[model samples]
Target: CLEPGTLPEPQLVASFLDLNAPVLARACLLLECAFFVNRCNRGEWPSWMKMNLPLPMQQAEHLTQASSQHIAISISGPAGANSDPID
Candidate 1:
C-alpha cells in the first residue's frame, strides 16, 4: 500500500510516465484510482508496484575495470597484442 502523500502531483506523475520501463511488463497496470486508494488504505499494494521505480544508485568502477581487463586479455590473444583494440 502507498502511504499518504507518497504519490507525487501530476507533474511528477508525468515524469514517471515518461520513463522507459517497457522491459517491465506494462499490461498488468491499470489506471483505477479507487482500487489504488483502497489498496493503499489496506496496505496491500503489489510487490512489483514499486519494482523498477527510479532512484539514484551508484555505479561500481571495480566491475568496470575488471570487465575491461577481461576484454584486454581476450583481444591480446596468443600473440599478446597489447596495442590492438577489440577488433
Candidate 2:
C-alpha cells in the first residue's frame, strides 16, 4: 500500500507551478524491480552498484499533469499574458 498524504517535494512542486504543469502527477502504480535484481544479483558483481528505473513512468505522468494544470491556470489566471495553452 502507498503512503497517504505524502506529497511530492517542493522543488518539484515549484517547477510544476512555474510551468503550470499538472501532468506531473502519477497514478502511484509501481511495477516490478526484479528484472534489475536478477541482472545484478550475482556474487561476482560489485556491492556499490545502484539502481535506477529503466523507464520513468512518473516523469511522463508528471508532464501530462503539468500540461493540464498549466492550461487550467492560464484560463483561470489574468488575461494579459501571451498564452497559448489549450483549455
Candidate 3:
C-alpha cells in the first residue's frame, strides 16, 4: 500500500529493496533519471552526475496520476514530449 508522490521512510525503502530488488532497482533507476533531467532543466548539477558516471542520460518528463487504487507514473522521453496530455 504505497502512496503516490510521497517518499517512503528510509527503513521502508530499504525493506522494499530487499523484498523486490530487481523491480525496485529498475524503478529506482528510472527515478534517478527523472531527477537528473529535472536538475538539468534547472541548470544546476551536483558533482556526482556532473562527473560523468555511468548513469542513464535522457531528457524526459515525469508525470504522475493518482487514483483510488494506485499511482500511475508516466515517463516520456524527448521523442514523446508532447505525448503526455496532463501538463
Candidate 4:
C-alpha cells in the first residue's frame, strides 16, 4: 500500500492504473477534487492547469489506443480546453 502523501513512481502508477482502472479512477476523482480545492484556496494555478487530470473521455481514448501488452500514459486536457493536446 502507498504511504500517505507519497506518490508512487511514475512507472508504478501506470502499472497500477492498468491493473485496476476503476479503483484508480475513483481515487483520482477524490484526489483531483482535493487538489483543486487546495489550489483554489491558495489562489495558485499552474501553467498546465487543465492538464492536471485527464477527463473520463480522454482516459477512455487512451485505454483504447494503448495495447493490452503495454501501457502508455499521457496527461492532457480536453480538446475544447486547449489548442494542443499536450498543453
Q: What is every candidate's alpha-carbon RMSD to the true fold?
A: 12.4, 18.6, 19.1, 18.9
Predicted structure with the largest lDDT when compared to the true one: 4
Sorted on TM-score, best first, the list reads 3, 2, 4, 1
In what order do the candidates fall by lDDT, top score first? 4, 1, 3, 2
TM-score for each model: 0.23, 0.27, 0.29, 0.26
Expressed as tens digits, the lDDT of each residue in 16-45 for candidate 1 is: 556676634222232344456677688776
2 against 3, candidate with superior TM-score = 3
Show the colliding residue pairs in model 1: 1-45
Over 4 Å off, model 4: 1-21, 45-87
lDDT for 64 in candidate 3 is 21
lDDT of 1: 0.56
Candidate closer to the true structure by TM-score (higher is better), 1 or 3? 3
What TM value does model 2 have? 0.27
Give the CA lDDT, 0 to 100, for residue 79 in model 2.
66
For model 4, what is the alpha-carbon lDDT of residue 74? Answer: 28
Higher-ranked by TM-score: 2 or 4: 2
* Worst window of 10 by summed lDDT in candidate 2: 26-35
**Residue 15 in model 1: lDDT:** 57
